[model samples]
Target: MTLSVTPPGTSSGPRSGHRLAVRPTRRVVAPEVRRRRRVQLTWALMVLNVMTFFPGAPHLLPIPGSVGKLIAQGALVGALVMALSVNRPLRVRPSVYVVILMTLAVEALLSSLHAEFLLGALFRACRLFGFALVLWLLTPWWTRRDLLLVRTHLLMLWGIVASVVVGLAVAPGLAMTEDRLGGTLWPIPPTQVGHYSAVAIGLTIVLWMSGLLRRSVALVSVLVCVPVLLLTHTRTALVAVLAGVTLAGISLFTARSRVRKAFAIGLVVFTLGDLTLGSVVTTWLARGQDTAELGALTGRKAVWEAILAQPRSAMEVLFGFGLSNKSFNGLPIDSNWLGTYYDVGLVGCALTVMLVLFVLVAAWFRPQGPHRALALFLVAYCVVASFTESGLSEASPYLLELTLAASLVYSTPTREGPR
Candidate 1:
């Protein structure tokens, strides 16, 4: 006897007269699907922040420049949070929010006394909201997959930045490194190389240490980039990268003394490199000395002194001079506390200091899996580099990336299972 078997969905025997009851196709939502949704929302916010670069025009408004940027950032971040939490409740981390508010208050106090258009700085400050928002969206909650995605983006950005720097270095009659590398255009200036290299090296170290990349690729990248860093002659950049990578290595390999020793050896080589190349080091050192005059050949020390002599009133000291002081063509404003003090005042400077401290602490203390050490290094290096660069301002590309990365680092969550 031959028997025919009907498919579950198809009718058989008496069931042929009725539509068969097909069990509903169960929708199995993988955990990754939910995670991807969060990632998408996070990336969308990042894209929006990136798009602001295309807008070109400085967003100056009555809301104050920093405040306006803040509004824009808040809008994007708020949208992202809302989207991510259709089912899950979205709660702001109190410490993060407090830091942000303090930063704004500092900006506000500075705005009241700023000599130039304080609104410009205000807008700039506001714009950074995106950076902070990015932290909230990506960190502590970020999975290994999300980190991989971040590494991909970072590597691409690093390649582009590196190519730009190298091309400019080789370009004929570029005149000013800052003009070509730090300027706002197709290629940014080298002004914030410290911040840029810090994050790059930090990420590289994280990937290598975490065993995320094949040894060959990581080794090659480190080799190629080291020369570029040297050629750029960005002392602060080197410092940032070394500090961050070393700190990260220390934190990540706390139990592995050999690895820490290796990292220390690398740092020694990196630092002593300038000494080995005697002529180059001497020349760069000479140039640095020449550049130290703060005002009228006084150097930054002089500028700081001049600022110190300004006034004693709490309001004047705290709020600042107001933004309408001086306007320069092509280049953005100077990178110094003097400029900030002259424009915004003591309160602005204090807030600025606090903001830097906050990021460094977060990087230093935040609970990331393998990335904890790396993030700390990046944050520390950035803080140190900011002393000489236009950190926390749209003027620096590296600052933008570092801030973005920091935000992401903090926002991402740790992987649940053991390594």
Candidate 2:
């Protein structure tokens, strides 16, 4: 006798024989559920990006250095991937700015051939490309602007808390120098901490002005960041913060009601007055003056002179000596523009300037609003900070924040009203 088995979800019967009946069920998820899931996933990714900067994360998690970098890079890549999967079909037409950025990346890679360490140069170039990709992917999330802003600030706040906690746990005394508060989570430089604190203050101001943050909370955040900023004692950071706050005030005053305008103007005047009259501020300025009067720029001027002294071929001058080339006679080139010129040459420098100018102009032309003001503030900070430190050169938390700001500025619709 031959016997046959029926497949699942199928029914079969012989004239008088017993038969099995089955039904198929489809598990349909509600659209709202899916949306919530995506939003949560995005928040998690943002947190991961921020946590990558925690000095203790890699060690605490027992992840290798290389693996940690890969994880960070993967998080960015994963965000892009998820966005592409859920969003409308990717557009074939590319933005002009993106094309220019791509060209610059290509130039950087080519210039890397002349670097002292080819692998290092390639790695740097790749990391930059990763950042560009991540930012580009963010352009599609303009519809979720509120969520994006909240997630970003939340992560930033977490970073601040983590830095303080880690600093206090390890080398608290070393973290804060005599008369200066430069506490940092290990692996984060004191200067970087200062820069972070400055930016945080600027962000808090904008958020509070926009009414996205409560006045009490904003005041508390500013108070918390100020001592850290003072401790860092980084002159460039101080200057950048001042420039950012001034720009923010101007932007707010221009776009707000008469009452708000008056407040904005008053705040600006107060900040300027404080910088001028505060004893500690004067002391900082005096220290800088003493260094400048000696023609050393606290050793930065000497580094620049050494770099300029090096004999270079026409090709090298036009296209740079390559990334990470140590032709500075054992001196560190502390300025981003100068470092770019040394690493990538005139062409690279021009590209960097164009990129910065484009972002600045874009932010300036944006309709008067808090987002526009914040973008302008960030761009101003980066521009001023670059003059003293190579803040824009590498893949760090600070650079990541700048990239996010630029992406937000570029992606935001010009006609949208203030949030």
Candidate 3:
């Protein structure tokens, strides 16, 4: 039938050889493998997103009787997602995750032995651990594009905050500051409000400097956020916001640009004016026996006084009595140094300090790219805010959200580190 002979290097039919010759074929990753990789990545991202939801904050989980139920539900959900991703090629490293676990350990040890709401604290700590895990999984190689994306994301965040601030300014009864500053979004405490606001403000400035927003819009939005600070009635928050703005100005400045210089000067003036006004109002509102006033200036002096009067032992110093009891009438221990010390004692406090140090170092050295200045400002604000607020604790969802946001923004890939 005179079949045509094929060329030597090409074959239209399969060949069998005693020599067991092998031929190269194009490598195609399995569709299932790709889908699984995508799922794993998505799960990791969801872990971070849920953590940012601030699941542990007071208002979000205010169930007094069924608190355990809520925690169990969260744990189960986390477990399910984790199990789904178990065989995926994703793993969390130690350095980025240890601090969170340590925090939980410290909380548990304190609660089991001394805290009033030990179970509550443990539940909250679990949420924080989840947050840390999400951060570790997502931040391995934040890039320049990532930094830009984070900056844009921060603008949206600030825009939301600014809108709330404007609402508070316009609404009378809606704006109230509690023992902590609580917001419409998070009715936990005033400190929580301030801490989150400060971080958002810092990020906004970064985005603005990166030209992520229209100058006119950014300018107007910033102005709107200012008056909202007044409504918060949080002297510390107002101060933190202004401080963040000023730092951003300094960072985004050049030797030129008269408007920029003017803005900087104006920010300084505004900050000082706010501080002066707050002090005046604080003084005017104080009655001679006003406990809040006494606590405001000196910061829980009464609480510390109560702690000092009570018994002291090496165990108490190292491992605190826990937050189960609010029995601070004996000594006036401040929440900053006192809370950890009172709950976990000296060793816990030391470890907490170490964790803070690590975060600070990571914040300082971590590449910030176009957002470096903003990241620094946010980190500084967080460090200062932590002193007055239970920032390290997962009890405040606002704080947790802001912390996660900050980590994401700072860790975003920039010419300056991993997302």
lDDT for model 1 comes to 0.52
Question: Distance from true position, residue 255, model 3, in Å?
Answer: 8.5
Candidate 2 Cα errors over 4 Å, as ranges: 1-94, 142-154, 169-171, 177-186, 257-277, 285-295, 325-330, 393-399, 411-419
Which 10 consecutive residues of model 3 have the lowest summed lDDT? 46-55
| Candidate rank order under lDDT | 2, 1, 3
Q: Write the per-residue lDDT of candidate 3 for residues 175-234, one digit (tens) a residue.
A: 453322344443334444444455555555556665665678767656655545444455
Candidate 3 yields a Cα-based lDDT of: 0.50
Each candidate: RMSD: 8.2, 9.1, 10.4
Off by over 4 Å in 1: 1-91, 101-122, 129-153, 162-185, 264-276, 285-306, 309-313, 321-344, 358-369, 393-412, 416-419
Better of 1 and 2 by TM-score: 2
TM-score of each: 0.63, 0.75, 0.63
lDDT of each: 0.52, 0.65, 0.50
